[model samples]
Target: MKDLIILWLSGGNDAWWSVLVAMGNPWQVLDLGAVLALIVVGMQIAVATCLPDRLWADDGTNAFFSQLSYLHIFLLMALTALAEEIFFRAAIQSLLVEWLHSVAAGIAVPAAIFAVAQRARPASCASASRAAPATASSWG
Candidate 1:
């Protein structure tokens, strides 16, 4: 997906690309990804039924989705979760753990960062990931 790369990388080969492209145990990745997808999808449905989109989302976000078919939206949401997991858990939070030499500080810093970042607007449904619950807070 061309759009996935652009959205994830924003047109540059920063260290983030290395983070996104790294490989892991096949079964492990599949299992975790599936769990994350399920969580996000469930959260998406809840948000749609419970909250007005205008409360959490902006017109630009609505316009972006308006251009896509249902299948595209589904795929976008799935990819968004995966990409976010890689960025927050696999990279930022892990790095924080090592640098801060404290697991609490590690997860805490990134969790706060994630909450702030998603404050930009209602992000694609929910950023659900069991391994990284902090990012999932946006799972409104």
Candidate 2:
């Protein structure tokens, strides 16, 4: 994929596994915290879905995705995840860490960039933040 190409070009091809770890570890068992987090997230989603559209506007994202076939949707989601992990974590973050000589700088700088870029496109970060209000409502 283009992400791998970018990583290779950045001289980070050898560290690709680091980005895979960021994506997630398939071998790791889910801990209590992970299970609890999933439960809380599911509850948040359920509550959010029950809310009226007036409180949480549709924003046409669901409408757009609704038009896609299930296979297309799955592929889109998978490829997007892979691309983001490789480009951001492997390429950009790795480059930043090497250049800045600070692991914290590497993580923080790419995260900020990702946040801004996601806001501009209203796709990645927006989806994650969509659950945020649901979380607040649950606490209230």
Candidate 3:
């Protein structure tokens, strides 16, 4: 994580805490993150409820989620988010940036890999929601 942050910042000087304390203010960063999270959650809720059924037709993905208790769902979502960030952002993307010497390549390569991975997953595996934020972060 520290190496990734140093590579990302391009200074090779920022400590690992820079990842946790963005812009030198952890509280402000957390507040902003919370707002963004709420917006994403609200958008998801709106999509699930307001979109036509045909838009989200019951594939095994729906069935997969429906079987899980709320606790399990939340835990899976948290774990998925953590793992994706660590792998896609901290590891793969960092290496791509260093190797390719291009930030755009760094972002696009992992996103393409992520899309491919998502497509390759079994129907009863992870949900598309788990990929949304990772994709967004890559392009954002």
Candidate 4:
């Protein structure tokens, strides 16, 4: 639903393809994505360990995901990665090049937007729980 709106916002551009096409290095892209994901998770772990529990994910966010099965989790992960990369990274990377007149701005702006947007709230996430959910994944 939101992906459709974002694609429309990009003036019908299929940036998912364009970004991949322009990048021209599949291995590197995959490696970068993996490294970035690992780094983010590591950082989150560090934050969780070191910081006081001053801030937290909305409890609803935890409850919502907890209800999903392994299949649902897999689907959510795949769809989220694909949809977000296309709209936020691909679309912004190209459009910003033209509008902002700087490659850095193009990359940075969208990256910030993506981060802030994700943190803002998970739509339909379990209702404002501060604690991280239990580790028992649906598959387990």
Candidate 5:
């Protein structure tokens, strides 16, 4: 478990280091896709929180659709999807296979580690709720 966590963190650090060296600096590049992704994510959250009841209304659709015309959104989404897949599915999985030196071991180790990492938030949320006793007023 410790080894897997270490590997994951180190891999991320290494990736960032390499990216910095190769790209000279990420901020300098006009990453339209990232900007678009951020705008989309922010808008989604804003709509969900501020206008939850009307999110699916015609006006909401119009507002959301307008963002789609921005070229940066498409670029950001494509780059993000590609980068995530390569990092997690290819690079991390391949490294795990190399370290474990067995197909089953490699797959199992990384998969288990990945599952645990991914589920940490939900698991913690569940545990926290369970730990808190239900109150009559809250339930009502």
Candidate 6:
């Protein structure tokens, strides 16, 4: 978690720097707003497209909204994307570019690190799910 947070802050700082360099106006409110808006829209599109049918499929008795509000889900997705982009794309990769002076190396290094970091959670979840039935049968 701490590593992730550090990555995010660094990414945000790098993103700010990149914008400053490209626009020569770091403090431009409009540019900042546009960047944020783009992030949100991108997130929404990704979610809408990637979500499982069980979660978003049309059924006459669909209870998705009742079970989990759209706002809550949106907030979760936004926060995750913001954190990931900031840490992996902005901060770590930017640092790597500065160190190696190679764009491909910079991007690859952080991407690999991010992929490893992300795999931990899902791997653990899968292991736990696989063990669940065995544990239940042992109790019976």
Q: What are the lDDT scores of the predictions, listed in order?
A: 0.71, 0.75, 0.75, 0.72, 0.63, 0.70
| lDDT for each residue of candidate 6 in 1-140, tens digit (9 for 90 to 100) | 23334557777545433444556554664666687789998999999999865455233234655676888878877899999999888889999999999987997889889889887666665666566633433533
Model 1 ranges with Cα > 4 A deviation: 1-60, 121-140
lDDT of 1 by residue, 54-136 (tens): 45634246787899999999998789999999999999999999999997788889899899988774444444233344333
Q: Spell out the clash pairs found in candidate 2.
A: none
Give each prediction's root-mean-square deviation over alpha carbons.
Answer: 15.5, 12.3, 11.0, 13.2, 16.0, 12.5
Q: Is candidate 3 or candidate 6 better by TM-score?
A: 3
TM-score on alpha carbons, each prediction:
0.47, 0.54, 0.57, 0.49, 0.33, 0.45
Q: List the residue pairs that clash in candidate 1.
A: none
Query: Taking the tens digit of each residue's C-alpha lDDT, what string does model 2 give over 1-140?
Result: 34445776899845664644554644432453476679998999998989766566455578898899999999997999999999999999999999999988999999999998776955665676676545446543
Quote the lDDT for 79 in model 2: 100
Candidate 1 vs candidate 5, lDDT winner: 1
Per-residue lDDT of model 3, residues 1-140, tens digit only: 34444567786565544565556666866776797789999999998889865455343567778999999999999999999999999999999999999987998999999889877866433455454434433432
- TM-score, candidate 6, is 0.45
Off by over 4 Å in 3: 1-23, 52-55, 119-140
Best by TM-score: 3
- Model 4, total clashes: 11
TM-score computed on alpha carbons, candidate 2: 0.54
> In model 2, which range of ten residues has the least summed lDDT?
24-33
The CA lDDT at 110 in model 4 is: 90
Indicate whether candidate 2 or candidate 3 has the larger TM-score. 3
The residue pairs in collision within model 6 are: 7-87, 11-91
Residue-by-residue lDDT tens digits, candidate 5, 41-92: 9998987788744233332345766777668678877898798678766887
